[model samples]
Target: MQLLTTYMVRSQQKFATIFLISRGFTFQTMDFQGKYHIHCLMQLDLKFSLSFNSFTGNVPADLGSLRNLTKVTFSYNQLQTRPDGLSFVTDLTNCTKLQLLDFGHNKFKGEIPASIANFTNTLHILLLGSNQITGNIPPEIENLNGLQLLTIYNNSISGEIPYGIGKLRNLMDLSLWGNRISGPIPSSLGNATQLLKVQLQENHLEGNIPLSLGQCRQLLLLALSDNNLNDTIPKEVIGLSSLCIIFDVARNFLTGPLPLEVGNMSKIVDVDLSNNRLTGEIPTTLSQCLMLQYLDMAGNLFEGGIPPSLRTLNGLQYLNLSRNRLSGQIPIYFKNFTMLEMLDLSFNSLEGEVPQEGIFIDTKRISIIGNKELCGGIKELGLPACKVHNTKKRRKLPKLKVSITVTVLFFIMLTCLIVVVYWRRKSATRPSTALPTEERFLKVSYAELRQATDEFSPSNLIGQGSHSSVYRGILDGNQLVAVKVLNLRQKGALKSFLAECEALRNIRHRNLVNIITVCSSIDFTGAEFKALIYDLMQNGSLEQWLHSSENQSDMPKLTLIQRLDIAIDVAFALEYLHHHCQTSIIHGDLKPSNVLLDHDMVAHVCDFGLARFLCGSTNLDASQCQASSSGLKGTIGYIAPEYGLGSTSSLLGDMYSFGILLLETFTGITPTDVMFKDKWTLHQFVKAALLEGTKILDPSLLSSEHLAGINGGQSGDVDKVRLEEGVAAVLRIGVLCSEELPVERMDMVNALSELCAVREKFLRHGM
Candidate 1:
């Protein structure tokens, strides 16, 4: 150790300039006076970038003696104290030539000392974000006249922004969001005309926007939302022609007519003025902003019809004028706005038929509700007709008696032709004997299905399950379909196959996979069976994406919110089956493998081979009695425990399966994996984790702590925060649906209400 120390000192003295170490090093307290008389040897260097590599002990203040040093970087390191604890780089002021400095992403704490002003002459970029720095921005910061970028976000800073901040004439980017800064925005900030991006949201600032901000002509993004700014939007803001992006003034107390001059910002792309008190008719001039793509004026007092001029905005993709007092007929010209993807005009007084052409034809993407007088072409809206009635007209008719003679002759010829045509078709296409509808499946010829599937080729197969295989096919001039062929003998096992067919034929739901038709036939070799056809799900089954190792690279990982969405969709399907069907249908098998996804990743339940329909007072014991089934009937891990005890399939079984699926979604782990066995089912795993605060689940699936910070809350306190009130409601439904006892669980209606509550919350929160 002594030899190494001697070598380091001898090297430091010879270099007298910058030095860098290629490997890790450690250090302890050193006596500056005894260290090679270091004060006079002004240029000292380190062998490695400073980091948390076991460098302990206090930062030596005597190191300031290196007056010739120009750069110092000590990020991610554990220095005991800032070299000058209560001051900012004061000891290094003697190093007048200092130009670059980086001390970020570390454990620096306490207020940034006002002495930071001493670097005013040379510092160009200052990044103190992502640290433990606290306290108010010192008024002395106005002295950093040469500073170009200042980012102090993600800290515990407090107090008002200094009014003299306007003095930073060279400042181009400033971000002080995600802090506790309070007080009115200083109008003097308008003096920083060179600023290109200004983010001051999520603060406690209150007051009207200063009119002088119009002077920031170069500003491209200005976010001041979620504050207490009041009064009308200053008209002077219209002068900022360089603003080409977001112009959000949501959630404020701003009132009065939206400025017509807003249309003059032709380059603007998005404008949000939601949750304000703005009144008056939407200005037609807004259509003049050709580049505008998103317009949200919801939760306001805007009135009158949607301006006809808006139809000219072919680039508009999202438009929301909901929760307003707007009145008048929907303009017929809306057909011209073909690019519109989302249109919400709910809770308005707008009247007239919703256009059936163009974007409105896609009813799923539009919401036009709460307008009592409004009528529409949408089938689900149940809107009344608006055609005017006229009841005073008369017409004369000519009598015809001779036509009967010609009609009688024509009927005789038609009857003979029908007889001959029917006989020929019956001989060529019909079967010798027709089975009763209740006992028969649609008779599609084996040859036709074989052609549709291109000779049952492996390349045409879309999916496969334990008891069946699914193939994609094009039948009858290009009608795409998925054919699920059950692996069962056709002639001898008619009863069992028919029962499965009857169960699926009777059920219907948007989220339950739709069966288009069925094929039953015998082939030339005397083999026969039944196959059900359904709409092809473009994305295939969820199980393949979630569990197949070979397909892992192709499958997209679902984010937390997407997983929550899929869970809700599956719950709705189960709820519908449990309550809305004429005779309750129990999808005896509910698992990710049975749930398919469409192009949008919307889940659809498929494969109803084990499904059973329950009639009133039916003997469930006999009805649910099955032939010897292998494995677990359903997927191994998702099968309800009661099913193993010979319990009749019930809604509770589906709930148990759904609970397992939910846990799988949250943990990104399959319930049947070996790692989750022996009292380690997903249900037990999640329950244990939440109960004991253990790290049993993958951390990547958890939302980051900083996400709460974006909404003006503490990162560490997020778990303590209640699930969003509406999400809490849905969660209650999930809890009720997954109750251990069958009788305690909620019926489909109640469960659906809970799920709808989540959608309501999203609508209310403008998500």
Candidate 2:
């Protein structure tokens, strides 16, 4: 490896003058000069590569002395800082052949030098992403006319994007997201007509989206969310017929009805126009986009019923119209969307009986919540009975006829009295009973569960974790349930077993898994144990969707908004357990595997076997003892460091676990994976990156399988951009939640609020 490095350096000196040896290559200063002199035979061809046996130190500044160098790739390995006073190799102007420069996925720091623009003659693709490069994007970058793909995302580039950016006429993809860039998006960018993809989200960019962008006829994807862009979406954008996906102008002050022309975009697929001030009814014309797959118009002012034509969209997989003013009955035509996997119509004013036929048969797929007038078909929502009222008036009987009937009855009563005495002796032989009152909960028998589970057949098991096995079963001959049989033997472990049962019984939240009943009895083997019965969550656990190797194409991969929603759901559930429950419940073990999802993909935190209830004087004593003892009580990677330091398990401990879960949700990697070794808490990982202005998690770490499932069968530029933005949003939320300082981390309310803000912004942008 060393000899190869030497030969390349010697060859570069004879051809290209400049060379950069990254990855800690070692060479004597005298030998380096000799090699450069030896290679000074022709036009210096700047070239360099790292060797495995290289010595570690700062990148040498002397390489800048070789002026005729271009094209450098020094990524990976453990190379440290570049030498002080050295920016771009000063000798590079002589070579003028530099085009592709990849310095990403490295530990480079300091401001991007102004001299970077010197490569304007030939530079095309500049990848400075995933680095510690700070400061504003240099105006000189506009000089690179040949530049096509410019990725400076995941940096600390501040200040407005230079208006001169329009000069890059050949630019195809520009990603400047995850920066501190502020101000309105430059309207001049519309001049870059060749641009196909543009990502400028997760920044401080503000003001109206430029209507001039309609000029970019070839544009396929555009994302400008998580900014302060304020203005109505331009109706003229519909002119971009080639546009397939758009998440423009989200989290902004935009307000207006959706342009009717949006329906004209026949090629468009996914649209996220949520969390905005947009008013007026959703245009029925949107139904014309037959290719539409995912539609999220939640947290908007869209009123009236959903468009009837939407039912014709058979390819639609996910639809969220939650937290809106939508009214009237849920359209019966929704049954036509058989391919739909998730439908959230919660917090609407819709009324009437929930549909019981077709897709509605899977109640979990439909979320008709916060609609006070809705009734029937579900016990979970406490729906009123669908009763028919008699509209016809009854005819009255004559009073004289009634008086004659009373006289006949008086004589009959005397005869009946004698008959009653004769029958009383016979009646005494019959069983006696008391009048029955209504019961709040049903008593399900253990034998019945065994029968429902087919005598605990392994084939019926849906999931098996460290604590229990969850099985899908039918109860009372009809109702479906999820039975979680505990691993503990009830005969010997009655105390701890009962404690868990009591904890689950007392805790109740819409987001927490509901415990329906408990079965505690001896099995055929005469071994007693307990099993918990809950409403069957057909969607399965979140871990399966995130990390399972099953055929998941049939399942809907969570969009950015959906992931945030689930994260917020889990956060709120934890908050309620810690603060609102009768006793503060510590979910000693909270991980993705324990978080179950219903058919709608709404998350429910399950598995409370290790839950610790803190209430009363006994709780205080236990707390003190736990605080003084060094013991860990959480998942391997998620447990807070303070816990090992003998700190009491407080709400903060749960927060730490939540942070890990958040990161896993974003990266789609398990905390226990080899990639996250070396005491690398997700919180610490994200925090360190943010402090250094670099991307915390590598996007490549996302499994190809998961990415394939998310983007499978999808083509066109818009679909790609939408998917990218969705991924970006998830990562942003993860970073925000995993901030090292608990105070810096957003609370559940604030996190949810911000999420809704992002949703509304997207809606206004007509994404």
Candidate 3:
């Protein structure tokens, strides 16, 4: 290591790139005595990135002498300096070509140097987050007119945000959250029309939100929550159509009614205005936010009835209106809110009967703890049964008896007609068959299904399962479909059929197979017949594409990008079912065969027969989900190890399965492959291979044709590095997801984020 350092110091001109990422080596503390030779390298124009390393001691002060330096990232290191000093920052002013500078997640203390204004106007990004930087942002920062992103989060910086920041027309992202900043937001921020994301949450900012902020027509995310802001939300700000990700102003002192134009954010996914002083009714206009998935207005002063139009939010999953002044009955139409998962209406003045349908069936999911007038929910809610208040009307019942006698005489004649019809049905001996109470499927007859499948011929058969056979067919003479016919001869066939109908009818997603129709009626043999029809997947199941006979010659191999896309699609599907659905659905059997791909290779999760809904969305504290299922809920190779220990099912279990699927996709090896024997499981196999580089990756992804010239040129090696990095990221995520302990596995959301980051890096690195 000492020799390498000496060589780097001597060959300064040739040292163009300095990368020591993830080497896990620690450096000794050294002050450099202000004589570091790196100052000589400044003339050569270098690009240095030492992220994810264990570098200690103060950063080299001479680094600022590199005028030709373009980028410097030193995040996630152990670097530190004197508590009240940032001398190196002042030195960096000489680097006229510097466009990116990041020093986040380190112990950089003291006030940010005023010399920050000396940075070149070409600088586009600056990240100083997760540090001990103090004092207010220097007004002189406005000098960097070309700045695009500025993040200084998790700092002790104080004072009002400078209005001069608005002068930077090129600014697009500005985040200063988790700071001690105070005072009202500057109205001049509206001048920065290119701003797309603004986060000022967790600050001491006070007063009303600036109305001029509405002029940022391109803003996508606005988070100003956890502040001292007061007054009503601006109507124009609420009406910004470009705000799509989230608009959070919760935990503030804001008052007055929400603007009626709140419905204008059609593309927004989350709206949080909770823990505020806001009053008046929830705007019925909120129903117009068709894409809303989360809405929280709890701990407010909102009054009047819960808007009935809220039932129209078909995509809403989380709704919190608790601890408010809301009165009147809970909207009866709330029973139609099929997508609602967590509904908190507790601590309110709401009166009358609570609807006993939809999410209301789960006591843990729907809270009404403080609403004394609420009654008639499930017995578990401990509310009294609803009763009539008008007892005086009982005395008038005697006068109606004479009229009731006449009505009885008329009913006797009707009974004679029913008896004649009943005798005819008894002679024919027709057995009454009960059908499952399906929710949202086209009700079809047995004859229609038979005709669609050509009388259930073997030629139409596409796939066969334990208790059902799927056949490809055409419905209504044009709609291509896949009909799953159940065989009652199996012991649990009928139960599986009902379970699938109940599961699929209650949930829907683009990644989930669409149930086109269902047929439950008597067949030609006078016996019960049941089947479920789905939109046909032209490309068939992923299982066929992975392991089918290669001799067919027409089958297309899945490239690395395609596999990554499929992994993302499956992860999203599981995220929706496990976290975003009205109730968590445990996909007991997640396997390659259960994953269908359309003509575009977009994956759709299928076969909910083994699926079951968990009572609570995230109440996996004790495995209540697993206890709800009669037996284990997944296939052999992908099943979580916890399931074998008699533990209950949980979202973590599904994550385990997804992890196995990702590993299998990248390695082209299944858990049940013949080579996996004894203690050499797929997880251990892949984990070991990751230690050996890309030896376990699919050959088709890293063919010699693409890798041969990779050793010839600098750009070739860069592409090769990116490819390896992408593969390493995938393998790392897979190993983490398939950990032995369920709690050790990565959450689906975090996994998705890492996958996205890796993809972005691959694109940016030109791979």
Candidate 4:
């Protein structure tokens, strides 16, 4: 390590590209000392990138001594400052040739210094996300007329978005989510015709969305969910046909009818207008969006039956018209949506027989619970049967036909028994991700488990947590399994084990991590031992996909649609836990690492150590999500804001964690990222980005071949637009669900409805 450090110090002049990505190196930490940043470093046009490294300490000012430095990529590091408040950025102004500056995803504390404006006009892209920086963005930031991408997302930035930002004619992307910035959005941003993505959700921004945005002919994605923005949506803003990705403005006070001109966004993928005051009939012109996969208008005042033109959106995966005033028979054409997975029309005044075909075949996939007057075609719906009708054309059935049908039934019954037996046998295979929910309890000793994991060898260890260590093992029959051994020495390890046992005792779902058995015995040294054995997921955890390192070169990056599917699967598991179980269960911790993917890439929610059971028929909405606990539970960042105030665990808290998971999955940003510390949060960062129309996309989603598969077989540009829009749509769902206020947050039911809508198009295209 010392040798490498010395080599780096001596060869600073020769170092042009310091790309240190994906090594997953766990050696001792290395410090990039101030001595290495001297003027002798570069002779000409140097591009230094030390991303994804463990380098520590403050960024030295001497880095500016390199007059020829053009690009600096210092992301994903431990570099921090001591009350410096981003003063490191001040030194970089000396590099007049600098064009790109990225210090994102680091532990840098402090503000975006005023010197940011002093950088040469050649500077285009500036990234400072996921930091502990605080303060308002300087208005002089517009001095960099050549700026194209400016992202300061997930920080504690305050004050208004700069009014002078409109001066940058070449600007394309702007992301500034999760800040305390308040005031109206600058309408001058409309002049930046090159703008493509704008994300500014989760802030205190108010006033109407600007009509000038309509002038940005190249605009594709726009998100402004979870803020105080009021007034009706501008028709000029909503009518842009170039909006190929997402158009989100949910959780605002936007009043009045949804404009019929919304039909102009023909190439859009996801559109969310939920939790607003928008009224009037559902627009029939919405059928123009042949590529639409997700459409959410829930919590609005739209009245009428499901539009007939919507039948053309057969590619939809989710359609939510819940909490509305719509009244009429549920459309039968809904049965034609072969790709649809969730259809929620709950809390509406609709009355008619519910269709039993397509997505309605499974009661778990659809919700119509609050429509008391509706009758059902399926008995599981618990609705009254359709009224018996006597038609004038009643005819007698032939005896020969009845006899032939009876014969067929007899043959079918005989065939069903064989199929059932085969299914049971196949389901018993231990290597699969899913285990039989009901089985004879198996008795296993500590010695037997020790043998499966080679006597608990470190080499066999798969994962380690605060109170448990997981090891991969093989049973007597070559059955692969994961063994989570409890850490008895930890403070609450015993309680965690007990809680997990209680949570998993009576509930099971296909999307949930499956446990096989348990071992409570004594180890060789007479020490107490307890471990849980679960079916091993062949594809590993969702963390491996979203945050892949260089060691993961063999692992293909998950496409936007693929990530959407995984997120949907996790949401389904949580929905089953919080609402479908005999007794409501809350998985207190819901970060990406806890989500395991099977060989089929299906996500399974796991780690029930912090699970809570909400016993009773208490209504979650009325309860304000209060559940008693002795202390705070759940991982930081993902935990609900109320939990930090000694509020304990609740159904709402789980929803918050799920919301963070949704954001992380789509945007590839962790809930506890360095940028979301103190008063700043992941929800706000994403929200602000949506509101300000900034670019908050995870670049990994559009790199290499991932873009090609995002839009099915569409053009390259279309692929990018649709993929980004889909991501923004899912990110908005996350934003609403993870809002600071429990009441403002979308419940599990509504979130699932929106997610089901987001993943359909990709699934239909076989993504």
Model 4 residue 257 CA deviation in Å: 0.5
Candidate achieving higher TM-score, 1 or 4: 4
Candidate 2 lDDT trough over 10 residues, lowest sum = 34-43
Tens-place lDDT per residue, model 1, 1-767, is: 12113223222223222243212344333332212222233344332234323333444565566554566655544444454553446666666655655565555678887778888777776776656778899999999888788888777789999999999998888888778888888998899988888888777888888887888877777778777778888766853656778788888888899875675565788888899899998865566466889989999999887775575577889989999998888777666777788989899988777777776777688888798887657666677876765766645444454477668879999998998798779757634343334354445667877876757766467677556778776565235568877777432235445656766755667788877678887766787767788877866777776665532332445643455677777878988888776667777778887788886888898766767665342433444444323234566777888778767666778777776675565556777888775666655555555556454433443456523432345433433233333343443454455556677656666666666666665444433
User: Which ranges of candidate 1 are over 4 A from the true structure?
Assistant: 1-108, 333-335, 385-767
- Given candidate 1, what's the lDDT at residue 634? 67
TM-score of each candidate? Answer: 0.43, 0.46, 0.50, 0.49
User: Residue 203 in candidate 3 has what lDDT?
Assistant: 99
lDDT of 1: 0.68
Tens digits of per-residue lDDT for model 4, 290-330: 68889899999999877765776888987889999999888
lDDT of each: 0.68, 0.68, 0.80, 0.80
Q: Give stretches of model 2 more than 4 Å off.
A: 1-59, 62-70, 76-80, 83-86, 89-94, 246-248, 389-767
TM-score winner between 2 and 4, please give it.
4
Model 4 residue 638 CA deviation in Å: 67
lDDT of 4 at 373: 86
Q: How far is candidate 2 from the true structure (C-alpha RMSD, Å)?
A: 23.9
lDDT of 2 by residue, 1-767 (tens): 22223334342224222354334334334344322212222334456443222223445554544444456665443345556522643434444777777666555667777787777769887887766767888898899889999998887789889999998999999999899999889989999978888999889988888887887777778888778877688876753556677645556666888886675465677777778788888764465466778878888788988765565467888888999899988887777777889889999999888877656777678787798888876565568987777868666769998899999999899888988786676557643232211233457677878877767766467787565678766676345689988777333244445556756765678899977777778777787767888987766787877775533332345554566678878977987887776557777678888888886888999877666665342434565334323356667877766677766665656676787788787666677877666767565665565556554343542335434444343434564455456545555666665565556665555655665666665445333
RMSD of each: 21.0, 23.9, 19.9, 28.9
Which rank order by TM-score, best down to worst?
A: 3, 4, 2, 1
- Candidate 2 TM-score to native: 0.46
